[model samples]
Target: MGVIQLPSPPRILCFSFHILLILLQQTTAERELKFVVVVFRHGDRTPIVNFPTDLHKETEWPQGFGQLTKIGMQQLFELGQYTKERYSNFLNRTYSRQEFYLQSTDYDRTIMSALSYLSGLFPPSSSQIWNPGLLWQPIPVHILQKSSKQKLHFPLRDCPRFDELQNETQTSPEFQNRIQPYMDFLQTMAVNTGLELNHLKMLDNFQLWNTYDTLHCEDIHNYTLPVWATKDVINKMEKLAELSLLSLFGLYRREEKSRLQGGVLLNTILNSIKQAANSSKQGKMEVYSAHDTTIGALQIALNIFNGKLPPYAACQFFELYQESSGRYSIEMHYRNDSSKDPYVLTLPGCTSSCPLEKFAELVSPVITENWSKECGKQDKMKDIFLGFDVAVGLLCIFNLVLLYLLYHYGRCRRRNNYQDI
Candidate 1:
């Protein structure tokens, strides 16, 4: 090598050094994770509502109906622990007002899940330990007071336009086409399960999911399943339920439906991201402990729904990173199964790490700025009614004028004839 090595050319060495410098700069730019938004479905829980024929009753659960179970708490705790490990470098070692925020839907399971998750995420340290006996410390899990206007969750009720959109979705060709294949099975299920097929909307996928969940949970606990609860039946029900879910927030009038259901949450997330970009007052990480419906709706809005129902404790992550070039990008990852690594999700028109500006532009179509005003429920009906009333009034006036003219002409003719006689 020494005999073959003539001194390297000065220009070549300088060019190589310049290339190395540029790469170092690029590596530095990729180091920072500026913000994070983690949205997770609440962990395993007792069925919210069970079928009438089910053997399991509300009394069997210690917290009664729709409450989080010990298993759910443990699931969330594990999720929080995983989150802590992933963000150990980005997030502060111990919880602080500036470093973390947690929110949950206004329900017993979701609120409790948020609290349980917090317990694992921020185990008290020596400096902040209020009670030496316990490793947990109180962390705020905020919730909006339940009202007619609940904007934080998906499938929000009390929105007249949302209900109208849902009705429209149900009647769309897509919905009909999807349901046609399942009609006979659903009809039989209805008769056998004491539901009315004519009132199918009342027993939509969410309701079917309740029945399936009760059975699944019972089976897990060694409770006997009915003869009809075969694997094929369960899988079919699951598929149809997934389709019904898609119709609720996707298909046909997807954008409008998203505006009414998932878009509100999207807007919240966007605003949080924007705020995080500009301000330090807000926390670096925002966590939402919500329901499967919430996750499904959000995924549908994002156009990343994988057609299967999100499992218990499934998580979706939105991470904001700043590159060495001083530009920010947003990366999305979905963790639907605990056993597998989270899947990296790219926006349709962008890469896995989509620039912040580009990400916002792509998502703008689904973000409803003012949800109520955008809904515009009564305006169309009012316009149609007003037009109808004006048309009727014009018709009445024309008829009246025609009758007067005819009467006048008849009188004139009669007078002329009498004068001639």
Candidate 2:
């Protein structure tokens, strides 16, 4: 073998300096994750009975309509397991009330989902196991029903301004143009569903979405679809629903719409992030269990929406990290599929790992100081009367027109006994 010679002292010194520089850079770039925020939709749930023509009956579902299924429970349990695995090293081995907080919308599916999630996230360790037979522990999931200030529901159903905005969107030339080709198909659907031809002009796009939802839910649970709910019909309904939903949050006035809807939730999450950064006592995780609309609205506000219906059990995640320099950075990830890793979502205006301050500034325009004021809630009586008048006017038209060719495009079609859904 050829003899190997040692380098001179100067050469060795240079090599040592290069190694030191590499270590210094590595240390400077290192970051420790400190906090997490997750906003997620509830697991699989039965559809509420809004589409009268569907064959699914509330009695057929063991838990009644709009309740969670066992499959849903298992799905969330898996999510919890995934979360536990993801943070096992970072979080304490035993459960700590001080490190985690959970909230959910006041619905059977969401509350159950939260519970199922907790069961998976923190199964009792040997130290905390209370009973020999039971492998789980109780964790509180906060919910408040019918609260005036709750920020979890989407589209802000009570907001007159949002309603007004929606009507405006429905009437825009672009909206009319988009739905023009589907008018006859819509009429055929209406007649097939027992909704009269005259009533077709009065049907809202959301109602069309409801019809699709009923069929979609039926398929998920292995229920046979009616002859009317053909694959072609479903495909069209899906397209319409996607268009209508995206338009509500993005098409006409994205920032303004966000200021009224998703911005409320965004504000809450940002403040929580700031508090976590500034305080030593902040919880390690904050979770909000809500619905698809909630996640869609939040994503739209953040300018990271993927322009598709968020599937059941979807999650939008915010993770905070403390860098070696003592500054904080945030990373956003979205998980809508259980089969693959969550997708890394970069804020529209920043790098993948964005600084906390810069992230806040970029999203400031969407945040609202007073949601009620921004939503046109000046006086109780004024809002009620105005809302009634708008509702009456709104029901006269299909908001998202589908009978434009057969009927006079913009003429109102009246319906009796109109009520909010």
TM-score of every model?
A: 0.82, 0.82
The stretch of ten residues in a row with the least summed lDDT in candidate 2 is 412-421
In candidate 1, which residue ranges exceed 4 Å CA deviation? 1-3, 6-30, 148-150, 201-205, 377-421
Q: What are the lDDT scores of the predictions, listed in order?
A: 0.82, 0.84
Residues 142-239 of candidate 2: C-alpha lDDT, one tens digit per residue: 99574658669787778888878887877777677777788898788887776665444333446776677778888898998988777888998888
lDDT of 1 by residue, 1-421 (tens): 3567655699789988999999998797676899999999987776677786676677886777777778889989988898999999889879998788887778988899999899999999989998899999999998966673645566877678777777777777877888888888888777656656665543344666666677777776576777788889888877877877788789878878887788778878988998888876767899888888888889888888888888889999999887778788899999887778899988889999999999889888888767767776555678899999999999999999999999999999999999999
Please list the residue runs of candidate 2 whose C-alpha ends up more than 4 Å from where it truly belongs after superposition: 1-29, 196-205, 379-421
